[model samples]
Target: MPESAHVTEEKTLSESNPFPDSIPERLRAQWNFLIEVDKLKTVLRQSPLAAVERRENDAEHSWHLALMVPVLAEYADEPIDIGRTIQLVVVHDLIEIYAGDTPLYDAEAGRDQEARERAAADRLFPLLPDDQATHFRELWDEFEQRRTPEARFAKAMDRLQPFLLNWMARGGTWQAPGVTADDVRRRKSVIGDASGALWEAASELIAEGERRGWMRPGQG
Candidate 1:
């Protein structure tokens, strides 16, 4: 037989038995969910990467937030379950893979943001097997609510990551028109609720940005 014929035969066999009967159904479902969620790497957010090469994608953002949880957990106003916080951050922005990232300062985009993300969550989470789908959906909801200490701390890191990036880049997003020091301050106020120490550090960064003329001055 020709080499081309042999290649076609192998492709057909693999397609017929993509997963061997030995693999459990639940494990296959989990694998499929993992593959589907990889699309998050293509969903770009408005925040610039620390290197300033381009906008950071949802996958990188989620990973960075997850890593920040341990390093910054001590700053949380109350004790938090670090494991839960890590899980929360990892899955928190997965919905953006479908709904798309909404820029923080775009008031026009803010109106329907929650509705759009909720719909995306509904469409995406069920890709997992039943139990995992429910668990992930609940974690995403908890992070959004910001009621628990873990959620609050997770939210703080979400805001703080971009804040640090912008400041490091000499006001990457802060340079956008109409983005005053007060605007940045107002947007990041939730960090204060999580930890006064973190809030003070953010305040110092903001002041430095303003002093360097990287941030626009607020109106008198």
Candidate 2:
């Protein structure tokens, strides 16, 4: 090789030097985020459906709800932005990486859980570029309010999910963890305005569970 050509190649390589060890180098962020999300698998709960076995993790729940959005789209109460609704469902539970699932009955505990979730979102998503992190945080916040139609539909699915588990899992996980009638009622009430039909369907399912003795009497 020519002497001038060798110097040029060495200089180019030095200019491409990587980010420091203390920081998340761009390439490492994606895998690190996945690792954090995978930790959710350890945070399982006794299911309401198959009280016999625990429910799936936050990651599974998020994907499952996202898939259900297309089929359930027609039933939403408000005219929804289906794309936005889908996006919200996809990222909603990322906060659980920091704040574990807070069940309905734990009022005091549930209160501060949202704060922790927001912090987790910031840490996990900023691993992406600035635009991506901001957009994701906003989607998560929108779901939190349940104000818009898209958010409402997303919220309802989140609420309905547990019932499906309990209904099919033979009991929904209610008895094993001892979710009471009052708890079931309060949680189901939130689902009403989001999708009147899905809410009614959930109500019917709960009633049937009660009838068959799958659920405790007076629950829902």
Candidate 3:
């Protein structure tokens, strides 16, 4: 072959198969990093806090709260940045993909949960480019602090969720766990600051559940 023809062929091959480091990010399978999150829902935590029949997996819990933002927005005491709150809920439980769900009462298990979750985030985020990862990490941290209006709403949604499940299902999960009326009341109390009306509703529902024997009586 002529020299010009040979060089042209070499250039074509280089374009087709660049070194891994030189490959365009658009060609990378980066967005697929969260695929592992699907497996998280099946990894059930050993907590009687919820029962199998009404047991919500981590993914369902995350997705439910993520989509529930609009329907439950009226409960918010003030206007919320709904878009940001939605994003926070979507990403909030992704770390459960690695760390598993820690229970509300299990302080011992929660001790290193932050570290484990951060490490998981590190592994998962790098699957995306640096900028995307940084944006997500910042949002996740803000959600944790509950400092922003959106974060406050996000936390409120989180609390409201299990309350709905436990109540709607007639304390379905808690029925077997022997979750007391006192426990239910205590859990719903913190939600008051974010939305007093919703807390009132949840509180009334808890009382009914106790009356119906789905939950224990409040301590005297």
Candidate 4:
């Protein structure tokens, strides 16, 4: 082959395969972590899409929450760092890639959820470079603890998104056997700690769901 043609072929191969043998360990680790988290796309949740028949997955759920942070920032009970809040939203559910999703209403499945997710985090987060793995884990832990304003607001969006989905689907999960408005109210009441306005709106949606016979009537 001509030298020029050989050079052109090498260029094409190099362009197509971006990874080089000398790539730093940090870059390789970060790339692997990004690729591994793609499994979140397959981790399905209980909430249904408002416009379609299928359920949403964890990746979609996190993206929705990230979007909600900036759009609904004004409703947060206290001021929040929008970028940090979005980061918290994105990190919150990545562990489900390894742990799998636990439905909000599934008491049986939830019994061991924290243990499962903690184990999953131990395996998954270390895929990243050490600094990033620690930062992301801290964000995940913060979201779980809900101790900061950003974490609280992030949690509110987490709770509120599924609530909105159920309302839009005309009782998506609420129609499940043995679930009731009271159960939902108790579970989602954390929304109040972050955003009273959103929680009030959520309460209204729950009441409307009960009125429409979408929810099992809770005994007073």
Candidate number achieving the greatest TM-score relative to the actual structure: 4
Clashing pairs in 1: none
lDDT (Cα, tens digit) per residue for candidate 3, span 34-138: 444446566453322344554566767878888889888877998998888899998887766555677654557668777877776666655557777788888
lDDT of 4 by residue, 158-220 (tens): 999999999888899998888998999999999999999999989988988899999998775
Q: Summarize candidate 2's per-residue lDDT along 1-220 as a digit string, tens digits.
A: 1111121121212134534567666555554455545555555444442344555766677777888888789888888877888899988876665566766555665677767667666666775556766888888888898879888889888877777876777665556455665567667777887878888888777777777877567722
Clashing residue pairs for model 3: 51-173
Computed on alpha carbons, the lDDT of every model, listed in order, comes to 0.83, 0.68, 0.68, 0.85
lDDT of 1 by residue, 1-220 (tens): 1111121121222244466667898887777677667677877777788775798887889999999999989888899999999999998888776677788887777788898789878887887899999999999999999989999999999999999889778898889877899999999999998889999999999988998999898663
Clashes of 4: 0
TM-score of each: 0.88, 0.76, 0.77, 0.90
| Global lDDT of model 3 | 0.68
Regions of candidate 3 where Cα sits further than 4 Å from its true position: 1-23, 26-29, 45-54, 105-108, 176-178
Clashes of 1: 0
- Model 4 residue 213 lDDT score: 95
How many steric overlaps are in each model, in order?
0, 13, 1, 0
List all candidate RMSDs to the true structure: 8.4, 12.1, 12.4, 10.0
- Which portions of model 1 show Cα errors greater than 4 Å? 1-22
